[model samples]
Target chain A: MVSRIGKEIELSPVEMASRYSSRALYNLAAGSPDPSTIPVGEIMNSYDRVLSDLGPRALGYPGAGGQESLVKEIENFLPFLGLSIRKGERLVVTSGAQHAIELIAKYLLENEVVVAENPTFVETLTPMKLRSSVVLPVSLDERGMSVDELESLTRTVKVSIVYIIPNCHNPAGVTTCLERRKRLAELAEERNFYILEDDPYRPISTGVPPPVKSFDNNGRVIYVSTFSKILAPGLRIGFILANQEVAEKLALLEQNDFSTSTINQYVVADLLKRGVIQGRTEQLSSHYGRKMKILVESLRENRLDDFNPPSCGFFLLLNLHKDADSVFHTALTKGLLFVPAGPFFLRGGETYARLSVAVAQEEHIVKGVRVLKEVLSQD
Target chain B: MVSRIGKEIELSPVEMASRYSSRALYNLAAGSPDPSTIPVGEIMNSYDRVLSDLGPRALGYPGAGGQESLVKEIENFLPFLGLSIRKGERLVVTSGAQHAIELIAKYLLENEVVVAENPTFVETLTPMKLRSSVVLPVSLDERGMSVDELESLTRTVKVSIVYIIPNCHNPAGVTTCLERRKRLAELAEERNFYILEDDPYRPISTGVPPPVKSFDNNGRVIYVSTFSKILAPGLRIGFILANQEVAEKLALLEQNDFSTSTINQYVVADLLKRGVIQGRTEQLSSHYGRKMKILVESLRENRLDDFNPPSCGFFLLLNLHKDADSVFHTALTKGLLFVPAGPFFLRGGETYARLSVAVAQEEHIVKGVRVLKEVLSQD
Candidate 1:
């Protein structure tokens, strides 16, 4: 009874991560924030105050985009991430960054060709893939998605969209440099295609450059970011900054999901109001930074292919350069869980493994690395 | 660059309601609940307790379906609405009942022919229309959507699905009779077509017979209901009770939206756990009941064509028996507002108006009806 698109739907990485988080003693898979970093008491207080102060007003219909106060807060917060809302631009709040991508993919892409990093985040990629006729993946260098290849490909294929994770690129951990960001923005304008600059990890990711959207003179870049990384995924708050016309159109599509949860907006808005998020942001940076450090050091000390650690955010990806399937099975028996990077790529990532430290304690990260080393040495 | 489906998306009734609720002095348009009865303090308490108790755990990634506690709560609460989760039946929580419709419409529906009531809830119908090749409208009688017409429809058209708003029908406040419900269930089985029993207002609706799902021996009926009407739309919580296979399929589709807000789920589960919703249910019935009474009485006392009031839920549709365009315009000029029934019907409903008492207080309901009566009498 399901449709063709429905049949094509697979278990997303987020779902796989959730399973690993629960089942594994040493969970190195999920990108979910470490529970310790979430400001529980602050969130609770903000929610209490919002519910009490707004009464039923908070729970009533939030109209099209979102709670007005939250929208303003989001606008204010965007500048901190080196993004500014330009004239003739507006914002639409979505359930999450993933939802923002779904709206763009389903509404904007007309079964046309899409371009993304070769190892893209398929959680977002699946929606775009299902909607579009084809997704052409560009190779990634140290500076992020290779716009040079994208520029070359644009000669043959009329690309409708270019989706990129600018900071701490998933499965590759390459931040787009400033030079590349400007070139990508220029490429988008020249090609008359949209650039979906997906930047969910910016708050936690270090050594970030200005987002590609920041450089776009035209309204070609749609900046998608979320509270899930900084605040909590349970908050399910995200927004997209786009041209006013595009934002209005996406808001119409958003009516189908009704609106993002009213209570959540109030809480997040209140959290911003009370300046709780900044503190939470620092806490997250330190928390994830410490874990990433331990994992990278363990990898180095154990002489497992020497690589620099991701500056911040979740876990770093490892290019196993060996058969991933057997290693994965062997590790599964020992209860050390890590996400295989093959699913993150639309094509050609069969041997890579993404090891997330989002849920792992330091000891587990150390021990999990030891197990990975032993597993790799057996080959 | 927008897709055809995106181009076809319209401003839904929920969006329209949000606009009217904000702009109108006396809103007789929005189906949003009366602010006075929303159990604000109770919700505040529940939210506070849940956050304090669950803390970071509440804000983490909820797996595919929903928070386990909330699912159990929803399951326990199902019996009160004359629905039950039978053996081999499962549930998947959604952002809202509107969202449930979108999921089923998008994932389950192919470009097949769909059947809905002539004057159906377009908020839900729009998604179905966008997905399906055609939507055949069945006539509605005093006993709700005419089962005989649906039976005839199946003969002429190979109907893939039959959609119905079973209780306190959105524009027509009639409930389905048990006999018709049984026959519809049987027809669905005999014809091998799915039945989407949309029952958002079931908790507040009165004189509702056992739902069509109750009569189904086979899993032909997918029950969609929400906490929006009974609790608040701000909660943005709803669920679909379907066969395990069907539920699993829908859950996989849900991974796209990620999951419904975890905090909202925790708050709702807490409300259910504390039995606050039962008190809130009684509160809503009496509160809406009084406003509805005032609106109905004013309509009759002013010698407007007499009509029966909806037993409960948000609004009652008046067969304006006049050019609805002029009536609506005149009412607008006089600072009174109501929904024109034109958009509610896919076919014809040119002269009807739907008057809601959901948001208006008793005095406003009385005054709004007076203005509406004067506008109608001028003809």
Candidate 2:
């Protein structure tokens, strides 16, 4: 007897990409980093050290909110964002930033209203849809989520939470300006709504503004970040920083999966202590920056479409005059692959496409963009 | 503005243990395995081999159902229970068996009625309570969940799922008879209810019968197992085996976390390939068997309490003459630790206590029993 799943649990873009992974050539549909950049050797060293030092305790069930030392390490690391771990602040390590978001949606936002950017990270929207009754999509300009539109929506309907990717916004590649960050935080305080600042792409990106959490003085923002972008996705280490009350609630919700992987947490803690992640993030920023530059220059040289080049992060959002879905299908046949922006929005995004420069090599980037150029020219 | 979590999301036994972890001298509270029994070196070797062989690919996102090779390894390993992986069967890897149970409750039993053993694994009940409107607790005799009670319950209330821990059942230490297993499977098919056979403790235990899944021929049983009890809990690797349709649904539910750790999956796959887990299981069974013997003999000599010595698994269920909660508090003062079974039951279990011989040394088991004997005698 099979149980029926809700529409929200159906296959999304990530699963679709994974399903047709072998058929894809350029493979830019999912936002996975270049595999070569992962520090396998360093991680191996960390594993050895963690296992040898801790023995079987490393394999034991981790404390709720994960290992204390790792939480402390994250506390020490947060100063890099111009944010300090306050006295009453609590950190709960999660499977990833997505899991952290899911926990918040499940425990806090039941039957509530959530506001997200129009072309947002689709995976984050799934949890809200499953839990909240109303998921409002606000339009985004170059500076990121239009506060005027958000305010206009909030005046009519009470918003419980606002989900945002402030730094290097996914699918759009537009960073929220410092002014917008302050205004968003202020609006969250004024409207008495929680802001879930999902900032996974911040660590490995350069010239990024501090997270909206840094500007939140009234404990209105819950900061979520992941090592998936900066370190390794397989490690599945992420943490949430919130007020003690909210953090305790999150920890209670985390009891669903017990604690996250204890070995992974210890391995990450060792890496953080050794400053391995800090050094790697610097290397990754430059490496991805170069790839983004190559993809942008190739697109401009081919005189195909109009788009703003992202200052940092793995993706470049192309605003095409043609339908993105048709172009995506045509380019797929011509051995090029990238995510169409249609699925990213709750409403309309037909002319938008997101090209990830993370997975492809320099030569592959050049080839893939040329194929896109050829397909668009024919149209 | 901290959002309030529902009362159902309050602190459970696991969280209670974590909150006072430092206070407990002898931690028999949770059923964690002995550190010495963990095959740390072999697991480390597996890690080394997996990382080197697969490199950064091992660190990337796994397939929706998990790594194909690991799924195959699990499929190959399942024949020990007299069950073969049928062509139409599929496997979805989970963070743990608990997570597998959670997914089943979330996706399969929403707003439905669930039948669980009265004194079942407390963590399993959490998800069911969160999702299902009616969670009926069926009584368990020495042969495990009473089929008569379940049948009677199902006659009145429509049960969507029957969750049972057939082999070496958690908290109760009672294994279901083969006849009961067959009947339960039959009843599930007849009642049109799914059976979630959670069997995490089967591998490392001795003389355990085949799982209920072996008796399930009509695709009514969904088998959930984990590497936590046998290999290492820190790896957080488990699998769910079901018919293709149900398996696909489970994979869709697994999308919440995206996938389990890829590196851990690869490591487990390598261990299975090398037969390390098979060899280690034999060693662990003997090692834990000796500890169980010591605990039983000590309890008998000291006239501590009446109990069924668990033939397999980590726990021994003690039937105390005195109140279990009072005895637990008294034992704590005397530096002895064990779980009061009152919390495990949905109804009355004030006199039942659970002792875990998994974590303590042989001397500690004897000493703890002596202390427990003294504390009970005082009443």
Candidate 3:
């Protein structure tokens, strides 16, 4: 008796991800944080400290929104990371950034039209699609999502939400320029639509502009980000920064999960109290930055595929100029792993493939590119 | 553009619950497990060990359904607790029992008819209501939710799901008899409806009959249970046992949360591997058993109100024979907290209140009843 959702989880990309075995393959396919950058010792200490301090309360339901100490830490740290709740806005802790997207899609979408980039993260779009939202895919340019296209699309059909990555877009790592961020906010204000600014990659993405939310004077931008990129994905800590009304609605909706792991929240709170998150995020930014640079340099040196080198963040998309299926399969058999682009879009991207430098070391990045060149040349 | 959820979170019941202060008030209104029963040392050791061993993977995504070690532990422990996921069955770990319910309601309820016990747990109903399901409240007799009413209701409307708290039912704390369990399963097979056997209180509840899921041969029953009663809720671990197809579908749905806490899962897994849960649960069963007995005896001794003594589990519903509003208010001022019945029902529960003995000590139970007696006599 399942209610048939409009979109289903595509196994092709996931299968590509699985092919990237940890010790076996030249893995450039995962979006996971760099293992070296995770604050293992500090996280261990924080867990011990939180468990000892909070005792049983750490394992209980953390109130309506979240644990007070954790919320305060988030508020204290967000501004330094270029997010600000300010005046009438509030926040709610979530399981992860995906859970944040699910809340907005499940409660606020109302089956209205949503706009996303042509080649975007499928994970971000799945929950929105599950809510039966009519999706309009907008293409990205050098500046990011074309505001002119979004403005034109709004005239044709009523758009309720516009989901934007803004910084280090998945599959296609394109950072929105400051002008585009402001323009996106302006468009949301003019259209009376909400801008779901998904900023999961921002903290680890180098030189990110202020969030679209900063430009949203009319409270049309809902900011969502996660600790997955900077801290650890397994921690499953993400938060939504929205207007108090919407935040309250989300908090009430979050009651559905009982609460995101209270112990996890408290541990994160302990880390934040010690100011570990800031130093760790800076370390992650540089670690991923160096890896992204190595990947780009090797790809350029080989001159195997047509792609723009991303300034920062985990992923870069290669335009294979033809179907990437043969290239992907041949590369996989050769012990190199990168995701095919078919699953990252509403319809197209058959001629593209996404390469991730998130978990790859400098050697793997260079070696992975050499293998990709061999596969591409043969294809 | 927030979707107007049909049932807004009832503040009244939540407000009644909130009136329970931790340190000062005699908290007979909470479903929280006793802090004394929490295996703090074991959990702390487990977390430290899992993190030290697994390193970065401990804090990364636990994969599709859950962490492998945790799922295996669930597979092992469930049968010991009288829940058997035999051939063709599968399980997916959730954030909590509430998350398991949310998944079913959001994905399966297609706004179809749902039958729940009269004065059911509101947190469970809130998610179902959000999915626009037409909920039909069925009253409970000694055995549990009246199967006759359920059978009659199914004849008129297509009942998609019947949510049952089989063992130590919340609010009422009524255990469905073994015959009733078999009958519920048979009714589901005949009706082509699903039975969501919510058994959060089973491990601690004394003399619980085998679950309705155990009686089903047709794969029509989905079992939902949690570690909150036996362990700590702040860990936020719960699971669902269903047919492989449904389990896969639910796992696909769970991709929205990225994953439940990986660290928490590993910690729980470590504890399970060490067989800490078996001993801990037995201790909890006896500890809570004594508390329930004391509360019932004290109430009977004082002749405070009308209530059938619960054999086990956390709660007991007292029939006040009059509206409990004034009595509740007066009791609260005199340092007592018990949840008023208004919030537990679909419509009417004015003459009742649900008392919980989960966290209270023997002294608090006796003193709470005396307070109740004084409040009742004043009214």
Candidate 4:
């Protein structure tokens, strides 16, 4: 007998594309990098050295509480983000930021109200919704999650958790300002609700902003960051920082989920410990910075539609005259791909589409924008 | 505010250990292999080669379904376990087998009756309970999940899922016979319940037995396996083979989570394709086999406990006379560590404990068993 839930799941956009399209069809949709551009050689070298020290078991099940060296290194890494958590108090290595998010949902949100930005990364919403938590979307503008809206909403919704992308917000690439971050932290403290600060796109930019964790005094903010964007995503390495209470809950959740790859954490920790990641971050920021410039300048030159490139992260939100889904479908035929912002919105999302600058090369940027110009001009 | 569910959320014994004990004190409670044992050097070689060929993008967000070559390798690897599904039918590469198990719980079991062996793996039971699935524990003997009990239960309860350890059962180390596998498969077909054939330890045993998936002609078996035990768990690479309907549903669930680490998959596929894993498996089997024998025979010679060395896998189930928790706690004081078997049980699991012989060296096994014997002799 087929499961009714099973029948409801639509095939993912990535899988469908693999069947119809040929040869890595410009994947701006899934918010992944152009694989050819990531620095695999250096990572492999670091992996080689780490494996030589750790051996085969490094690849086996990681420690239930994460490897000590990695946790310690992460502890060291957190200070740079403006949070000072000891390895034991606040750090955990997860399979990905998604796992960390899910753990927080499982541990903290118990059929309670979860406030998320209206147009947000859909994956972040999965854990909360799956847990049967009442999801209340707070509308976001170019300044990230609107604090005023959140403040107003929390007063009524009895919010259990607030999921925010403080840095270069996904699908919208809007970084929250320091004042907003402080106000949001204040609201979370006042409401006595936990804040899940997801900042996966942090290292790709030169500009440093105060994290929610930086403002957290009562240990309410659980900061989640990933090496996936900076080092690589396939490593499945992400860590969360919170108080011991939250870390313990996450540790318990991870204990059941199977701890993240042990060696992946080791390899990453070794890289972080040895300053390999910091060294590479310089190259990564420059690369994304150049790509962001290329995308913004090209869109302006072509005058495709009203669009603004934010200061950081991988994507830009384009204000489209036509429906985002129709533009996405038509652009596929013309070999230009981008995520239609319609799917990002839980409430109503019709006028905008999200384009990733991470994978768009200079040549592709020129060609893609021209294609977008032609396709939009036709309609 | 503390979550109402947070206070209510149950944790496995290992999870409790992670929470209560210091990291050093919690060593033996967790069943994950020591990170020091992973074959990092060999995997790093593959990582280097892959990186040279593809670069950093390989580690970025993976193809939503899975990496193509890695999925193909997994497809190739599956026939050995008696599963013959098409390339894209119902196979998904997950973060780990643990994640795959949770995915099944999410999609298949909807508070429906699930039958697992008593003294089961905690990770398996955690997700089932988390989903509020009605869990019924079948008894286990030296031959694995008691088929007669399972058959009788399947007939009575409206069973939707049955999780089995066809090779070497975790905690139990009992390998079910081929006849029982066929019986289990027939029961699944008869009752229309899915069999979750978890075989992480299958590759570790030189003495291969018939798997339920091999006998699964009716497509009721969703076979799961991982390189975690054999290669590296930290790679967090595992696969689930089911029919097209089941596979597609799991794929959507995975897309919601982080897609399997792409670069890890590529390196794993390379290891498989290049014959590295095959060579490593032989070495591993021989090495862990010797360690297993030493631990078993020593236990017999010392008359320390009533336990059998696992026929295959890396673990041994000890049925102790004293309180299993106290016995384990005392052993840790003696600087000897092993997982207490209480957490493995679905229902009654207080009297048993699991010791992994895989990681303990031959000399350490002799010394460890001597310590265990002394501990048992005390009082």
Question: How many residue pairs collide in each prediction?
Answer: 0, 0, 2, 28
Q: Clashes in model 2: which pairs? A: none
TM-score of 4: 0.91
> What's the CA error at residue B375 for candidate 4, in Å?
2.6
Sequence-dependent TM-score of model 1: 0.97
As a whole number from 0 to 100, the lDDT of residue B340 in candidate 2 is 80
Best by lDDT: 1
The alpha-carbon lDDT assigned to residue B75 of candidate 1 equals 87
Candidate 2 lDDT by residue in tens digits, B1-379: 2333344676676456545546566666667777888889998888888888889998987656788899889888887555677778888888888778777777786577888898888777787777777678898777888998898887888888898988766788788888888889889888889898889888887677778887877888899988888888888888888988788877876666653788888989999888878676778888878888888898889876477667777788788887988887788877776778877788888898888878878888888887887887783
**Candidate 2 at residue B345, lDDT?**
84
Which window of 10 residues has the lowest lDDT sum in candidate 4 chain A?
A15-24
Error of 1 at A191 (Å): 1.3
Model 2 lDDT per residue over A117-169, tens place: 98898877787777777788998778888888888898999999998888778
Give the Å shift of residue A260 in candidate 3.
0.4
DockQ per model, Cα: 0.75, 0.56, 0.63, 0.50
Instruction: Give lDDT tens digits, candidate 1, residues B269-322.
Output: 888887777556666677777777788788888776534457667768787888
Proportion of native contacts kept per candidate: 0.80, 0.54, 0.67, 0.63
Relative to the true structure, candidate 3 reaches a TM of 0.97
What DockQ does candidate 3 score?
0.63
> For residues B1-379, what per-residue lDDT tens digits would candidate 3 score against the true structure?
6665613554436434664675336888878888878878788888889889989988876666778789999999987768777899999888889888888776676667888998788888777776655788998766788888888888888888898998787888788888878988999999899999898988775567788898889889989988888878888888999988788778777776654788888888888788887667667788888888898889889875477667678899999776777778888888888888777787688888889987778998899888888888872
Calculate candidate 2's fnat. 0.54
